[model samples]
Target: MKWPILQAFPSFSPRYLRPFLRLCAQQSALIIGKKLHALILTTGLSATQTSFLLNTLLHFYASCGDILSAQKLFVEIPHSCKDIADWTALMSSFSRQNRPHDALRLFAQMLENSIQIDDVPMVCLFSVCAWLRDVGVGSQGHGCVVKMGFEGKVKVSNAMMDMYGKCGMVREMRRVFDEMKEKNVVSWTVVLDGVLKWEGVRSGRLLFDEMPERNEVAWTIMVVGCVGSGFSKDGFLLLSEMVFHWGFKLNHITLCSLLSACAQSGDVVMGRWVHVYGLKLMGTEMDIMVGTATLDMYAKCGRVDTAVKVFECMPRRNVVSWNAMLSGLAMHGRGRVALDMFPRMIEEVKPDDLTFIAVLSACSHSGLIDQGSYYFDNLESLYGITPKIDHYACMVDLLGRAGRLEDAQTLINQMPIPPNEVVLGSLLGSCNSHGKLQLAERVLQKLTEMNPLNTEYHILLSNMYALAGKRQKANSLRKVLTTKGIRKVPGMSSIHVDGHVHQFSAGDKSHPRTQEIYLMLDDMVRRLRSAGYIPNPASQVFSGSDGIEDDAMDLEEKEQALFSHSEKLAVCFGLLSTKPGTPLYIFKNLRICQDCHAALKIVSKIYYREIVVRDRNRFHCFKQGSCSCCDFW
Candidate 1:
């Protein structure tokens, strides 16, 4: 009664083998894959089975990035036998490999082959169209989906939304979203994120508010939207509301968004709090994104040491992590360290434009002119990255800072694209620094012609004229400004005192503590005089009539005006209010005036205190009768 040998052979189903082979492919278990292939052949099912088994095998190979194997297996399948799943899988594989053109070609071939299009193919095609920004291809995919009656499929609808959004066609995305009768959390997220990415944060917030149901993704999208639109404070506010008010748990994405917000806002305290809480929630196994955001937060908040610590502790580091550390070093004036990290980054993870920019900026800050030039040249020679306007501007700044004005101008002249305001402005700034009046005049002419509305260019040009004793030209420029009703931007200073920011401007006496501030300033001046500080009468501009006598009077009036300059008054206020040893930190809207600079050096030595002033250009750390800039700025 024993069964025949043919009957004893176990009847196998491809479905049971399909998932197993997929797992093997995903894990890159080549040995296992060969073993399974051999098993399929020995089982005598390879030839007898439908194309389903062969297509599954082909998909497995494609998913594993074995494109050659996939192509060979695809060839083995009869041309007339290609199905929708086979075509979709191959196209998706190509898309994943960043061969979008190949993917599109395959899609076109599938359509020509008259394969029955399905939801999967529609999603894949839509994604390819989006990546290529082919509005026409996207429309064709949409038409196919409509013909197939798959418009309601969530996956297909989401792909269409993404396509429209990326093409800057928010209206089309909205139409697709409106037609979807049943939207899951992912559906809403897709539409909301698309709107946010395309239209901006305000529109994203509007969509967020309109949503009836909210999820972690919804909140995260809104937080990112705010961050993208430069509303970091608003993003942080939204994050706080989500956690404390809404009782939502924070995820890695949420932490990244919140940390990014803190970085942009320079809110160190809030950033630290978020970092601590994130660690408590996610533990020490932080993802690269969260860790990078944390590093960026510390760096931007003037805690570069903290940023370095976070970076060093990261279990895994990507290009962004390296860039963050490099930027932190640059920001802290540790340009050598930044430069040191550059080669290491190149060896490890190839430098990008941003990385080079960071390195160039560090070189500019630390005056590493040779290294800066080498990197600048190498950006094109080695990396094949033609310098953009920003790169050129950085180089101009580097050479200009090093007193290579003519070389800087030559670089500008050689720029492939016409120099924009930033490039020319940088050159003009260098000219002003080096007292190259003629060169500055030429640069200013080009700048004013291109940017008539730019007030800073006019101010700088006038200052240059005044510095060179071109009194009539300066006077004429002033008259022009007056006629145009364009007032000089008032100099403003901010001092952090008693956990609040106190703002002051030139001739500002509106503060409630104005009388106390002035009295303190007067006393400080006496002390400064006793410490051998002498007033410089030449640090002023004449603003009266055209005659020599009136000009002399105007010069005297200008010197008196310097005494009331915002930075001087802010420093005096700090001296009066703060403890004698505490370092004073002041932020200024403009470069520190010459008189204020001289006065701060005397004030620092007289009071035996350190003063750190951040002006429009760079940090000036004054201590012991000298500034960090060495009076070069």
Candidate 2:
């Protein structure tokens, strides 16, 4: 293994040194590998005519992550010494680095040259295609593999499944899997993961049950599918089955999946339960990933203080861990806390795109205009995190929410890329909030062109017209919606109690306890009215604004509209079911309306309950007539 000994055998042929270089390539130590490379070069043991030594050298560098050196040698390789494996090695390096564009281009070059490619390179290409989620290239690769008869190969077939699966093409991936004559655990797992992505967890569970033999990965996929598909309770059930019944060791992946489900559903009880399980599984030695997930779940479930404790106590912190805390704070509207964590995070780990996005979102949700401006302005220069559409969207939302309508529009105009629907929608929402009819109309026109079928813009514009007292325009808009058969998707709110989630839409009365829920609602409204609370009429105007004639409604009708909103129904149900002083957590599909927020504040005081509402934008913790976000949202 010593390079000094390689020179002692000065008469050794390149063939004799090939195995050692191959061994070096497999082991992958930069310093140890560089030593071997120096030995080959110094001894002139690497022949210019023979490609075996060059291929091994290239593989050594590429696999060792010295990709630049591999690329240099790859480009300079003599025509006679070049081989398909050489290109594949480079492609794999790029693929591992998530640089699929470079890998795909190199693969195209191989096809153009008509090089004699086999399954190894084809498999690598498909793997990159899967990561890139490029359906076109994946189809081409699939065809090529079939023509070359590599489709029969398990590795190649599995790669196709993975590529299609990640692309959300569940049927294609399943087809590839079903046709494969020989299958491995990875083959089943890849297809199952793909199904989970496109299909729901129920579908993924069916697949999991159908598997002839389930491995750890199969179990992990089902757990992930359940949590990712909004069935956190199901995910926990799967995790328990995997560990207790199947005798599979509880791992970080399983724990993380459960935590993710708890975060998504805002089930603090389940989140804490998962936290306890993670501690039991890992003991005092907590992994960074599991710790991060636990912290994220607590923060998202309205326990920011607990998340902070976890962040401080984590044995090791990474970019991902820091991003989780920052994003969680952003979700809870703790923008100042998130910003304060940034400098400390900088000293520990370099911020990436996700980091900046979290920071920008925190600023946007918390009205940190100056802080948001600094981060959005200097993100690229300071952190080298290039701003994508989401980043730009956050910046626009920040500016728009701050009443800088013209500045938000200017930022949209100045975007290096065209503004997406989210950016345009943010500007439009600002217009709706500030009653800027002219800007709202301009933004609406662009939005309608971008997504002609979506009725949200139409509804928003109709609201704008009604708010501006343009009754004729509002009526014309409603007529257009009726003519086009466009109906707005109704907003919904959900609350989890004991293990089941109860969901309600606007004016909902479908719950089995609907009678009792409304009765409780009457009591709550009476109590709130007695406490000097009044139903906001503005809340009435937007209540049935989807083509409804709000101008025709009387004051009493408006009050009924406020009382019938989905969140109000869910809260009333909570009051009916839960104990006094118990916190009520409600999650809304859309932004919590000003009226609902105002009502919840008084309800919190009247009921002597802490009410937590997580809407589309951020968390609002209502306690004793005040909110955590302070009405900023």
Candidate 3:
């Protein structure tokens, strides 16, 4: 690839200088390009071959990210000598720098100056419009393309399809695709993405099958789209097809997307399988992205210990990797371990805003008040990171959890920024836990002012009232919410069995194995009662008519209601479906109630099986009548 030396060739020949300039641009060798430019000018080649060299110079400056230099060179070119390629180079430089507005402005200037438009510049302009998601500008570009008779060109037509698709004009995008006399993989892929975004996974899958040929990108898009649409199982099937049927090597992106799907669906079994398959594909050469995704997947699936192993196995770690690991630890209630990792992390890479969030949350969850306070105090001075709202919320949570209600309130009042609902909600949660009825009322008032329609705050306050034996007040709150038609989110629990996720709600009988599940539930209840298990009546949030306390219901009936809880049903179904020694992994949409949490500990010991429940707050690993949280959560 070596070029002839300057003295070794005819300096006046554009042929020799053109290739040399191209080489410099490709290598991003600014000094070499400038020297070559000087050689061209000194030899008076610029006077005769000005137009040819100017376009190359513009491209060189554009490639090197010197947009200013390129602009200057572009402006100095004589108006008659200026061509569409020069404009494209300048427009493309701005586009590459994410300056779509500037690129559009150049296009407007080209129109005003009466410059003849060509397909190349038109394609660049359409791409700029797509990046901006500006449907108005894209439509105008489309008209110009048609006027210039460039719509017949395949690349220009593909750009048009991409522009309309990105702008959310799906019908227009499809029309362009349908009318195209020629179509390539890019054409099919662009329209497929639009269908996935505007339509759902089913329609996207339909169009995907219609494609004459598929590439890695198309497969990856379907996988990611399926994951986002809550069809992770289908995404896995697509991956299997791509691998087993097509024999395509799984790229890092596809692997990461599959891992993300597993995490979202809480499918740890499939996550482990994907991890092993990724190892086979990449072997020991797995990059930071895939490794980080694996760590996050294990962490999110309630396997923090295995996530730690993945983190340790990574050949290289970045700030993102550290943050993912720390968040996982924080999420699983391993605050002490997360804190220990922070010092080591800072020695290699500086902590960012997200890092502090993870560290502070770890302290809050672990009730390390002293450590949390020290970190909060030194956030600005030592770490040069200011305490954001999330940090304030965590500090408030830590203080409240430690029974410092007055101090938590004082800190909230002293916050430089107004406290958000999350901060107020944390304080309210702690208040409920500590039975600070008066403080909880004040926090609830502020929360109501922030978001009146938020039924969660109301429910928390009502539950607090019920726990305090203020049955009348609790009923009143429930009646008001019912009148307004503001119902709280229903509790849901899901368990992944045999690669399919089964979800259950309170009193749900939608599953095909309902009869078997109920029989197992009956057996579990009899065993539990014999083991001296008594339902905590105070945790019965939905036991009565319209969520009112069922004062007339006897103890046995209340116990029946408790057993019908979503988590209980999921647990019973797991017990019936899984092997005796198998561990049950249950994911819940809300916090585990006091009754369920207590009952699960006994169930773990009596059944002689480990049960890992990932509730809204944290992981609860119940084993032998003990929970990993030590009953703190």
TM-scores vs. true structure, each candidate: 0.63, 0.88, 0.77
Q: Give residue 581's error in model 2 in angstroms.
A: 1.7
Q: Using TM-score as the measure, name the better of candidate 2 and candidate 3.
A: 2
The candidate, 2 or 3, that scores higher on lDDT is 3
lDDT of 3 by residue, 502-613 (tens): 8888888999999999999888888988998987766776322113345567776666677888998999999989999899999888888778888999999999989999
Is 1 or 3 the stronger prediction by TM-score?
A: 3
Per-residue accuracy of model 1 over 258-318 as CA lDDT, tens digit each:
7886665445545787899877876778888999999998876556678989988888888
Query: 405-502 in candidate 2: lDDT tens per residue?
Result: 88988888899999989999988888887788998888888998999888877877786786677868977987787799877777788887766678
Give the runs in model 2 whose Cα sits over 4 Å from its true position.
1-28, 42-46, 49-51, 64-66, 197-199, 376-391, 414-417, 478-487, 540-558
Model 3 lDDT, residue 296, Cα: 97
Give candidate 1's whole-model lDDT: 0.77
- Comparison by lDDT, 1 against 3, better one: 3
Query: What is the RMSD, in Å, between candidate 3 and the native fold over all Cα?
Result: 5.7
| Most TM-score-accurate candidate | 2
Task: Tell me the whole-model lDDT of each prediction, alpha carbons only.
Answer: 0.77, 0.83, 0.85
